[model samples]
Target: MEITSVLIYIIVLFLSTIFSYPFLKKLKWNSKSIPYKLPPGSMGWPYIGETLQLYSQDPNIFFATKQRRYGEIFKSHILGCPCVMLASPEATKFVLATHSELFKPTYPKSKEKMIGPSAIFFHQGNYHSLLRKLVQNCLSPGSLQKLVPDIEAIAISALQSWAGGDVINTFHEMKKFSFDVGILSVFGRLDKKHRENLKENYCIVDKGYNSFPTNIPGTTYHRALLARKRLSQIVNDIIYEREEKKILEKDLLGHFLNFKDEKGQVLSKDQISDNIIGVLFAAQDTTASVLTWTLKYLHDDQKLLEAVKAEQKAIYEENEGGKRPLTWAQTRNMPFTHRVILESLRMASIISFTFREAVVDVEYNGYLIPKGWKVLPLFRNIHHNPELFTDPQDFDPSRFEVAPKPNTFMPFGNGVHACPGNELAKMELLILIHHLVTKFRWEVVGSQSGIQYGPFPIPQNGLPARFWNESNNT
Candidate 1:
């Protein structure tokens, strides 16, 4: 009996060894295949992560500290998600442009709900491609050329309103101006009534966008969700009117309306409304924030402001003291002012970083980016990196005279998800700056040294300032 038991044990041991050999070999092969390590940095505490640490101080300081300690790429947990922050231009390009497929655009679920899930910002693949083409067509150079006179008119009107010298929040005023242009781009020559309705409802939605995402009644977020519904309805009303009148136009709404897929699919009304709101949301705050920073920067540097004024003044004189509408050629010719806008975009870096999610385990520069982790390309860090830009802290528009190194300057971002309306936004800036520098003088009011984030950094108190028409001053 003892011999039989010993024989059974020996046989079992031999069989186990034979079966486990392939498994052990496969494990060893996998280990050898993946030799990369996670990028160095703290993940903070579990669940809560480093969210408090991030929000407690200047986000720039937080990121700068991490980059200094851990080099360009580092790991941290923020807002309950483990993330990899990439501060190098090469890593940014790899994630945003080259290996874009390996990382997908990501936003908070609340944000997605507020912006609408079908908006091009939240999409990938064929749907995103289709929407992008339609938007590009709407804002094409041909379209923007026609828009110059109208945009000039908007700028003139905005300046005229601000000339009374009541200390107005520059950023708020810019919001109104950009929102109007956004409306024009979406709906060509919309009635004042419709425009007012859209603006009023959109303001509510905007207010709630960054509020805590609570659905309880009477909450700001709840109010925003309700206002979002009204916005959709307003868009639908416009669509219905167009269909009834059979009005075919060349605005963004027209493009969405006219699009037909190879499968003969017409976009749903909800889809149309979603994209329109998305465009407005994209166009308003960003353009306003940059314009506000431009105002502050120009105000702070009299010499630089004088130089930009000289450039625009030349065009203003050529146009016969603003009697003639700005020609597209004239708008294109303001090189100095254009550089100021570019530099403002770089210095402000309003979109400090962008969020993407790793779709699969990605090996980048000998580091392992595990699947499902959030990846942030720190645009502000890259833009401010002294190595990338000499004395990045100073506001020097001339640095842009020489083109930045490849993948180094992405004010409007890069790759498939880059801002489609970048040209339009720049055109708006040129027109506004031309009118502003040539016809108006302004001083930034109150303390000018602090920054505030209404989700985007603007000068403290919205750069409170007073404006005077040049003619009025004279």
Candidate 2:
């Protein structure tokens, strides 16, 4: 009772006034020593922090509203931490593209709550660099090309199997599809029981994404904590087995298990397991949601539907591999499909806001972001700005089809720690959609608005649509 009282009180106070606002000014903090300034936005009502205000219904409206009031750079308390919201193209480029070193991923939770401490995502400095190098080698362009067929195969299976009665929750199927694909991509083939365990454990870990910092019964965090242990054990066993056999395979786990930095120091099983799960979490949910929204938008927009299907038909016809699947070389030619997916990413901006925290006191745009204070780019602000895009809300792919108009788009984020599997994820989704659209005609069959983002929200209202073989549909 006492602890809860203190936490709520602190959160309240933190929201009402910047906890260190007065202090920041008193220190005569001049980070003018820095190169770029932060873009501006507003802080939130007292206790709730800027968290709610920034994401308040249709996040774009709030960002636009704030930018109007605050201009190009502003400060706010978000998620109980003081943060500087940067939105201008110049500011965003500094934070994301140029001065990436000054800021890095500040996901709300720690490794204990998210992955584990040794995971690649949680490592800083040399460890993160080393891990990234090793992992990159695993998913190198050539390596990724090899996995395309497998990823597409999994996607197709889910779509066909789940669409039982001309009605189905595509989001649900997409989630399952990504989960299975991620598992296969990372750990390779698995028995049904093992697959179920992986999914259930991942669910627990995912629940932790927004869970409070508590282990008490009935709390999502508690369940996630339990799941973490189970996952660690399963991964540890696999790592050891792989190590013992000295076998090599195409999966992410195999790559991690066998990796060594140039110094030749090998990664430990714990590190491998931690990084594996961390990467899987990063890959699966977001990509799945991307696929979900892509299907929704393409089907609803007639011109877009024809454009997408036409592209798919060409890919299928030209594919030396046929529907047997595509190599990255072949998939790369479908520019229209890529444009649609990129536009979907811009519109959905699934990762509405990516976060970072100051490890040292920093000054930008005449404001001080003190050590440990959180920061959010509000990527969607840049993604949806009318100045940056045409009819920002409209489903237009041509915006990205030709040369990108500068900082107008950054769906997978930018700079270091940006999604690495972008090419692989893109190929899998496009090919899946390509096969589905070319193979069957379909339509959304439910309340469009309700099918929105939850966490990694996708078309969840069950995108039921009448499907028929091409012969019947034509």
Q: What is the lDDT of candidate 1?
A: 0.89
Candidate 2, residue 368: Cα displacement in angstroms equals 3.3
Model 1 residue pairs with clashes: none
| Candidate 1 RMSD to the real structure | 12.8
Residue-by-residue lDDT tens digits, candidate 1, 1-474: 134543543344344434434433332224356778889999775445576677656789999999999999999977656789999999999999999999999998889899898999998899999999999999999999999888989999999999998899999999999999999999988999999999999999999998767799999899999999999999999999999999999999999999999999999999999999999999999999999999999999999999998888888788898788899988788888889999999999999999999998899999988777889999999999999999999999999899999989998889999999999999999999989988888988889888877779888889899999887863
lDDT accuracy of residue 271 in candidate 2: 81
Worst 10 residues of 2 by lDDT: 20-29
- What TM-score does candidate 2 reach? 0.86
